[model samples]
Target: MTPNPPAVPRARLPLRAADLRGLSRLGVDAVVGVTDVVEAMHHTIASVPGIVGPAPAGRPSGITGFVYRTVRATTRTVGRGLDALWAAVPFDTTASTPEREAFVAALNGVWGDHLADTGNPLAITVSLRVGGRPYREALATPTGRLLVLVHGLAMNDLQWTRRGHDHGQALARDLGFSPVYLHYNSGRHVSQNGRAFAELLDELVAGWPVPVEELVILGHSLGGLVARSACHLGAARPWMKALSRLVFLGTPHHGAPLERGGRLVDAALGLSPYAAPLARLGKARSAGITDLRFGNLQDADWQHRDRHSQTRDDRAPTPLPAGVATYLVAATKAGRPIGLHGATAGDGLVPLASALGEHRSPALALKVPASHRLVVASANHWDLLDRPEVYRKLRSWLR
Candidate 1:
């Protein structure tokens, strides 16, 4: 008989006596608040261009597009490794010690420091505004339902309001739902931060200054998975009972072909150490490269772990406590070409067929559209996160 896999430690679940010393000695158990992740992203983006060397020291600005993006991606891989180390003790010393507190405080400061540099969340109310208007006004009026908007990998909340795409705030203003933003490492495993997300949700909901009638989540691409993980893990806790709705836009319900993409990239880059590092960055898994890199979360055999373990398909439709409604939005536009080379499904990162939650049995499915991945014009993985269309549909559904 296949022996049950030795139990892995989850932050919220009870820890074994043997592991308690390890866990507590561990400061915070890699509790990746979206705030921490957003801060990390700020540091990364702010430093990337310089680290990549915009012109390679006096060279003409003719840095080829391919070379620039490649170097930029390489810098991202390095930054991600640093983020991973910051997630946990990294060293063998147990977290129970006071040293753990210092480490925890340092990691916590990562976001805090970045927020300070950027002024702050409140500063966003002013510094983050565009066209002399604030985003919170859309739905943050005295009597508005709180709606949280989450972004996907490689982007931030400001991206949501850039130029022609002010979806989150617009929804808040139009539907009378207050918009809250979620920031996290989308490239990381969906489950690594699941428990933390649950706790964050509890903190967000339980700590609401004013009573919020509803708590709705709109997650794009990887954000959807984060939202899903939060729902499942938080259900095991006390506060999520108030969460009312969830909306997924182009999220990879099943693991995206990204793993498949990773394999191809790995093979294409074999032998060169650069290829090895790229494989680590591009490898697709639930916990993400953050685990493999910083050695924070437990690692599964990237090449062969069970797909089910990587994703949360085991969830029962009725599993979510009654009261919350679930909705899905998918993109069919492929990054590949059309006619002779046009792709059939997905918006690059996620397959169109897979993005729709066909497998979620008896969950609160939507009546808004028919089954297949409808072509979302000019859509791609990143676009799903910031797409105006997505926010429009998401706001309507979340409302």
Candidate 2:
């Protein structure tokens, strides 16, 4: 009798293996970036006639050129060999874990453009997920009421279920609304992602198996900015008619203090010629990170200017959509005796005023009525995701 076929070794997940390759590429790029910085410093110093003279105008000897070429060719060959080896290995897509997926999403949020342009395996494509499956397959029948949950920077849809609970799942079970999680590369420009998201929603609505009755969006942190951006761009789309409510959780409507501080660091580094090259390190953060400096949601906000420049907040005001119920949730670390200072201090990353859309300029301020705003005391930022009290407030509003 023929013995059972030898058991096959389970292959690693494609993305997990690809992450290794992506990291290798990042190492190569880091080496190249350092070399470029050093070369630039050399050029800057040599150009100063008083301090240093330019080298004689002569090409390197044929032997030196050959050596350089050989080194470059060897490097390229090794890189290619590694890539080929990774490609040859089989991968089980089912092995993709939530932790690995979240880590990759964060990397994409930081260096997504590079990954997309180079067709790297680390780039995440935006899609709607239902029951942990792609929308197309999972959403066979539409439950009129739809709730879309968008995650913050360096996060993925899987991250929504935090500490044994997810607002989306609870809302669906409690309110009979269908919950959909958005997966996207958080590293891309907010406006760019916004536009794509608007288009994607338009298609989603049009393709629904059943009529869509009401649509609600719950966005956290930077996700709120993206949601607002999409609404601005898709104001005239048919799907807008179905949009009923928008809820922002710990979102920075004006800007985040962390990114603004990064800008200050970049400017300080630029003050010294010797240290200017180091500024590139700060500026190397993804466009998504830079856009947070002023909560930029439109292309005009960043179009032609130096993104790293210490410029005034010139982002065009994007007011909340009319006819839609807008809600703001701001969290603070301090409890009961929460004074103005504690409120302004916010949940550590976002200030209370910013989260509440309190801009000095009326034109830029989001007109969310006092009744629609909720402040969670003694809660940090991430707590907004799974706190029982927070869920109670959401249920009250959405119900």
Candidate 3:
């Protein structure tokens, strides 16, 4: 018998030193925040006079100050030592597991922009994935048609394959279209992600190995909002010329009721003097979560205002692109008896009206024709990914 070849080692998730650093920073911020809150509470209890309170007593001059300085120096030294130790460990950068990716995606969805801004190791850079590898490395040949799939909040690109079925792979096999999944930090504002996506798409199109003839986009939830934002921002770019169709899967075009409810809770907490400090806890939600309150798609929607304040829906209406064919898919939990509750409850996350873009204001309405709209009964928001009917509808549209 021939000698057996050596078994290949299974790839392990890389040790990310940045995660430790980011966590350390977050811990520091939390401690500082608590300190500030405690100080404020003490001041409130003391009933200090004037808008600006008097400064506290001066620092200790001798032994106490020396001891304080030594403690501070020791803490700094320990932190630096930990950082150095982590950095020295060799880590395989490319070895990442799906579970880890999902966790990071959720974390990024909550604090992605902040992480990216601070150069945190956990920040996910937006990119296309093909054959379980980065697109640039794996895509040696390209097809004429491209189908780009964008996932919802707190979701990674790997999640597209639900119950062993991925719409992108299905489309690729059935229609001969190339499928590219976007991996991004969902914690950033929709407009910020949109702008980055616009630039990335332009670069991608320019660098494509094959001449791109058509481009189609499928977005789920917040991903749809990001796609819409990209379209608005990329109107003048060359890549816009290749755009042909855009489909939304349970997108909250109008806004999400859950976020609105959260905002109400925050506002209520702030109304009472005793609960005012507790309001800060509510306000700790990421910028991305706040943007969901009004399905904000443009920078102007949030650039000037306080994101946590109970503000009216001031978002400028962004109509669907003139030439592109647009489609909407809404999901309802009820199978039969699709009555008020079924319609209003809306897949438990998004209401049917919002998913269908049925705004009372004509200016804000998406204008997707009735023929282009689909409603999946007995399905929740996430069910849109793997449901057979949803797949059939997608096939019919793209066919």
Candidate 4:
């Protein structure tokens, strides 16, 4: 007779064993990466005369190279030892705290692509959650009307509840719709997450306890871009049939200048050989963040291209999904609409024209009816999350 498998131990609050192991491994990687950067800097400085020559390729020679190599090897050895030590233990994750979730979410937003590529335990898996727990377990009685809330970059579903107010909960209370939050890694490419999301939605609708009557998605910041990507990719999928409305809050439909500014910094650093190696540090940002530079939604937009290279907006125009009711909401820090301040009035992150999907090229513009668009003055990007005015607009439109 075959014996039953050993039970995996569960722990409450703080963090999981896997989280610590992943972090330790990341620390080792960070050390190795920094050592490489330092070595490159040293080599460039040594090779360049008067600090103005073309940077040489590859690692340094002799003692310096040996020291850098040794550091990396030793770090990897320690990382392997930690991995084995942790593997010897029988603990598995069962629960997570809000703080832990936030930390992991932010880490994913920054190094999520790396974490995922390395199969790090800290990598966040896309999941449908209710009240910060798995929706399947928490959803006791599923309703026909489903309201899906998607959060922005560097954020988890738990962050949907801010300042003791949650937009999903409010909608649930005001209406009969059941709320489900999408939690995913925000460091991957928008297209990748979008494809995953589209598939997840298909599974959700197929397995829903009741026949789904109405499906609405309310996305904030990068969440809106993800939703758009999903809709574009899943046009032929069954979930698209149930999708009734797509609402975007402060979505950078055209692109965000902040990421463009970051690119400018990269370009500036590349001007000097001494600073060229340091430019790699900025280039290390996640693909998702880079996608915001031009609101890239398809893999073709980034595939086989240097993402860090400064280039004009060449994204294929993706208009609002056909036959779906769409709404747009934008925020502005300025007090009024017309003036010098109004010329650049944005939510401190995304510009008004971008958020409103207004583009110089007609093909790129997302044509939403004027009635479906709202611009909230004196409100910043985050204010769109739970602002009273914004909530009212959402309730009215959703109702």
Candidate 5:
């Protein structure tokens, strides 16, 4: 009888030793966070009976405090042990799989600020790349025309390739433009990423293999906000001189309602003493996520204020960069216009008016020319990345 064929091993995610260490640390943090919440709840409930004025604030006293403290201490000790064990394991410095890159990007988007603050290995450092590798190695035939593609929140450079179609690659092939991708931690504040990006671009232009004739930026969703921030901060830098065009696809220029809704939920949870402790969970979201509430692109916009507090749109007016051909692309789920509904109809996450840079306050409007705007009907947010019509428009404008 013929021997049975060897079973194929199930494919696993390409997790590294460093990932294990980072995840262990995050696990410890989670446990400590849960203990703090539980202790706060316990203290609040215990002090509720026959109390005057406001509920007692801060951690519980005596035995309760000791128990909570012990839990945290034990968790940290275990985390340190795990870190040492993982660090001892020899890790192969091979290229990361696309799945692993996506996972890291998403993790960075959710808790990137905390990860950076804690020096976690999972936190992605900002870089410019080509074909999942550093840009310098892939630019053997660098061209004068350059296209820089920046991805949206919770995304990495590899994500630009959708359904076998990448806008950057297509532009490179058709327009003789060399495409470079910007990969960054989307969980950090937009202003922070923007400043870093500006510095990177300054270095890139200064050290370009060829004289950069044109520098075009194609930004998607939150990527557009970062690009705008970079443009503003890098106005006096050398890279700005070569920047000729900027295109935004499905960008929330004003603000996204979802983030604002999240803030409202935070406010609602903060109203009751019993539920106040739970507010910490909402507030735990990264600084980058909070910046989306009003599309904050400058440090002054968020420096002193409590990000969780519900406030008016007090963002400083930032007009589009001057002397550059700027294009705005907005998408809507609805196939056609529908009167008053058209004002708010968007690509599920961003409103039409916001994407079009139409704000109630005149000072905040982007002021893009009418010819520079395009609206794609019956398209969702992600469709802006690869729809044939969108590609056609991009080619026509860039050409």
Candidate 6:
């Protein structure tokens, strides 16, 4: 066999792998955290002398005024939207009358939180009217296996639009396999969104256009964990019986060691002047972790679902269910340390071993050659879901 070549070099984030865990568990879902966004924005402005200092001639007086006006306009718009939403809440907790009762009844009728688009990074699924499209909202139907690809944090479904020449739609065209892209809030707790995700799957599977012969779930980073959890939760349903294969791409199966970095940031931020909006991030069993762990929802073991969630603290990854045939595609290149936190090994987001779990350990994990590469020409965590190597493997696996 050809010897493995030297690893590619890239700029490294100071954050350790162990410390950079699923931030959604800390509650930073979809993409980057708010504070980090603010910080990045702040740094961007600070670095630009023109942005931080006085405006150019014929422009607003100073940078502060510019910032204020810009911020004010944006905030005003958002504030009005929030006000309308709150006004629509239909409830008066202080009142004790028929109107309150009616409001409660109406509120109870409203089961789920509004799926508002707040520039949420988790909104990866492309919204298309279902009538004439190949796919919508991860909907799958049987003519053959329907593969739904879910991406991780800071990513969108467009990642899987295609690999090289082969894309999600192409897979459906050539291989007789159906492909759907999944997108959600990566910043939310894994289990919390996973639970809702399960519900969504239940709906999709139940309404599948044809008898779903099989389901192939492919997820990267946090999406992998969520996918597994979803499968477990759907086990009892008749629709779940159609699930045949599972694939995890750079998922932090046992939590990323780097998660600790967010925890530390939360700690430091708490002591600093920027404590108000950040207090939620630093707490133990943070919002991010909670989202993955059921979001304060009860974990009844009636079906033995979510059992893997039990040993998350263990160093090694756990095995998947007995019947399911699972596959893992790992990143061996230089980037973030997977599980060791600050130390190096595997990719930054997922440890090679962890990404594979027990069934698809790194030993058999395959690599994608550069000639056929696209966005993931041997890139990092973000590429696994969108690149050709991954999509190629998934298409074949589904077949």
The local distance difference test score of model 4 is 0.88
Worst 10 residues of 4 by lDDT: 48-57
Best model per TM-score: 5
lDDT of 3 at 103: 74
Model 5 per-residue lDDT tens digits across residues 303-386: 889987948889988778889999999988887734456557789998888898988899998888878989888888899999
Per-candidate alpha-carbon RMSD to the true structure: 19.4, 6.3, 6.1, 7.7, 2.6, 16.8
Task: Flag regions of model 2 displaced more than 4 Å.
Answer: 1-15, 42-77, 139-141, 336-338
What TM-score, to 2 decimals, does candidate 6 have? 0.53
Give Cα distance to truth, residue 122, candidate 5, Å. 0.5
Give one digit per residue, the lDDT tens place, for model 1 in 197-222: 67766776665667868777777766
Tens-digit lDDT string for candidate 2 (359-396): 98998998788889889888888999998988998999
The order of the candidates by TM-score, greatest first, is 5, 4, 2, 3, 6, 1
Clash counts for all predictions: 14, 1, 0, 0, 0, 41
Best by lDDT: 5
The 10-residue segment with the lowest total lDDT in model 6: 107-116
Better by TM-score, candidate 6 or 4: 4
Kindly report which residue stretches of model 1 are placed more than 4 angstroms away from their true locations once superposed.
Answer: 1-144, 265-322, 334-343, 359-375, 385-392
Q: What TM-score, over all chains together, does every model reach? A: 0.51, 0.87, 0.87, 0.94, 0.95, 0.53
Of 1 and 3, the candidate ranking higher by TM-score: 3
Model 4 residue 58 lDDT score: 78
